[model samples]
Target: MEYSTKETSEKYSNITSLWRANSSSSSVIDAETSPVHVGPQNSLKENDKIEKLFGQPEGVDFKQYSGYVTVDPIAGRALFYYFVESPQDSASKPLVLWLNGGPGCSSLGGGAFGELGPFRVNKDGTLHSNQFSWISEANIIFLESPAGVGFSYTNTSSDYNFSGDSTTARDSYTFLVNWLERFPEYKASDFYLTGESYAGHYVPQLAQLILVHNNHPKKTIISTINLKGLAIGNAYVDFESNMKGTTEYYWSHALISDELYNKIISTCNFSTPSSASKKCNAYLDQIDEEIGNIFLYNIYAPLCNNRSLSSTSISEVDPCLPSYIQSYFNVPEVQKAMHANVTNLPYPWESCNSTLNLSWKDRPLTVLPLLHQLMKSGLRIWLYSGDMDVVVPVTDTRYAIKKLKLPVKTAWHPWYLQGEVGGYVEEYENLTLLTIRGAGHFVPTYQPNRALAFFSHFLSGKLLPKE
Candidate 1:
């Protein structure tokens, strides 16, 4: 199902509890009574630092820290984070904050372990180095944001019901403010916001909030955040454009028949997607039927038949990798090492929080306006897509960018990596549009080397290689 449609339907469905049967009562953290704040910032950092993970590989050179930053002390809400400093010259490297979008996904689980952080989980629950890890270019922070995701939690049960875009952005901003206090060394570092999928909303919204905070006349809060730019992959930005693009992409890719495509185009009012006619809903169902059970994220990729270590490989994309990550994080020793699940959450840690995904309260129809505002503020903005991702397909991104109508600064052309065409790039007035060849919904997971290549250029403010 399309991301937006699936979310809307799930929103109205019954809310089933994913918590464990023996779950304990909610635990409240009193801000004043919490010992974490009683000590100096250095001591707090020391408490959060990971001397080593449960199954961490030997000879690992970089430092890793994971802990909670209380975003709402009154509500006892805190966001969980996993931080990895660069392997070499971390002092010189910029800081990159990576988020994953299930609207309620764990950035640590998805972006950190599953995609671009320094390590990947083996099926047997051991850690191996990710050769193309983005940590080579910057200190990466994977945040499980807006309480109720991953290990992030809220004591007030109603907070989950009220979680929305505005609250998330505010809390994430609060996280940065507090996180910087703990790691003041990186406060002056060039900071870039990055994420995939629903983070299309998270990244830009948080950036916009930061820009606004920086411009505040009174300047009551901590010093300004050194936010330099942002980049999103397989983003969900504009609803109408996304719907139109999805239909077109399916037809052009021969996933749907021409007759069905024509009917969908003529009958469905994409602008008012909630009011889809019975015929349109039936047509959409037919599309789902035709697509069958193949992974919609990457239509061409194979599905995980069994969650077995024997079938997994370090150099290849393992469809069952999520299962491995789930298993690894659920281990009691792993939680102790990472300083996660401090309250012993009733539910096991999950990559994506279904409750948050369905109950996301304030998604705007489009974040294009925020992008325009960011561009005007002189921030670097890049929207990229993985050609293989049918969920938030390249066509959808192209259509959304077209709505911005920015004059082209550089004509569209192929970008190269290691003497081969990596993908395509187009530079507009204040933004860049890019595609990663042979990648899917999670670009870094599907095409790590190419993702790293472009990510290096993005951090350095260099153009993608044209040769």
Candidate 2:
């Protein structure tokens, strides 16, 4: 789910033209695997259980399932998902769908393993429990959306080239509907959407689409997705605010010079055809020169060692853990356990897909309206940012909220965890602006305990404690 720092303004009207891949790659399909037909209600017994997780860690008592839900079977296209039931009493827990950003990144690899899933993948290719895992509070679902991300693939090659925000939303919704038919027990469960980074665009857009479909004329045919709320962390909500915030964050944090900042802010138009101008790019380059080799997502975190495959201790994961995860997911046993690689995909499992059309034609300049629309629908909306994240920094999140002008329901105050100041928040009508004290772009990975604490509160309709 990675996007270029620059944004493209051209909008393509024809959706079919977007996904034309080289015909040679996916023109064939196996006869045994036919297009899936939606089954009758309560006929979900088949996909309700996961056979194994290969080297699944000890002390895990939860039931988890991993498999593909056919999104467009004509294309033999399917999206992969990893669902973990809450360890203690999932029947009462809400179903939360977690997505990761890169626009093409793997949510299972990033969000599930690296952040809030029940377990984290060790460098040695073993599994370990994540005590702060979000599944501890709710039945978490991690989806590898759009064909070509993670194990999700297409037999019709063109689907790879045709992915964008709209298709992604449509297919993700389709996956949810079909997935429910396979597990009808959760059809009426309250759904809460969560994601970060480029998912800032994905989560809101999907929520907007779900809201629209909730009132479709033929509503009975479509299963009800009881959408209750959404939570986005270090998200890219608004382009102007994000870009302006990036520049301001660099300048304010002494990453850029006063002169360069002044020159770009004046010459660089945030509303450019590509969302960024040449002069703006040049100035950012200068800042890059000064911040050499540091992780932009978590400027203070230690870098991972690629060769030895070591980084942080078991306590905290290295941001580069994605490499280790890539190795882990590609294993035959792991794939078999996860019920993945059904058609023997041509390519290896990757963390960020490069085949996607980077010149996305459907991306909206800003998702602020979608956020507004969701809030107006009486959905619980919480925007949380990791203060240490420079990509979509906390300052920009605050700036975006200020622009929304939601009437303040509670004055700004420190929110506590374990008697310590975890962060600060200002509650607005139907929305909450929150900051995680020491986390980076991926809050769950960086500050797991606090992130889980914050999330537990958000999901339970309880505010972050003031003590």
Give me candidate 2's TM-score against the actual structure.
0.88
Q: Summarize candidate 1's per-residue lDDT along 1-467 as a digit string, tens digits.
A: 11221132222111111110121121111112111221135677889999999988889999999999887787889889999999999999999999888688788888899889988888789988888999999999999987988899999999988787777888888888889889989989999999987788888888877776777666664668899999999887777677788778888888889888898889888766545678877776677656556566777877665543343455588777777788888899999999999998999887777767667666677788778878898888888888987777899899999999999999999999999999999999999999999998888888999999989988777789899
Q: Could you tell me which residue pairs clash in candidate 2?
A: 1-101, 1-102, 1-103, 1-104, 1-105, 2-102, 2-103, 18-162, 19-162
Residue-level lDDT of model 2, residues 396-435, one tens digit each, is 7887887788899999999998989999988999899888
Residue 113's C-alpha lDDT in candidate 2? Answer: 84
lDDT of each: 0.79, 0.75
Model 2, position 55: C-alpha lDDT score = 68
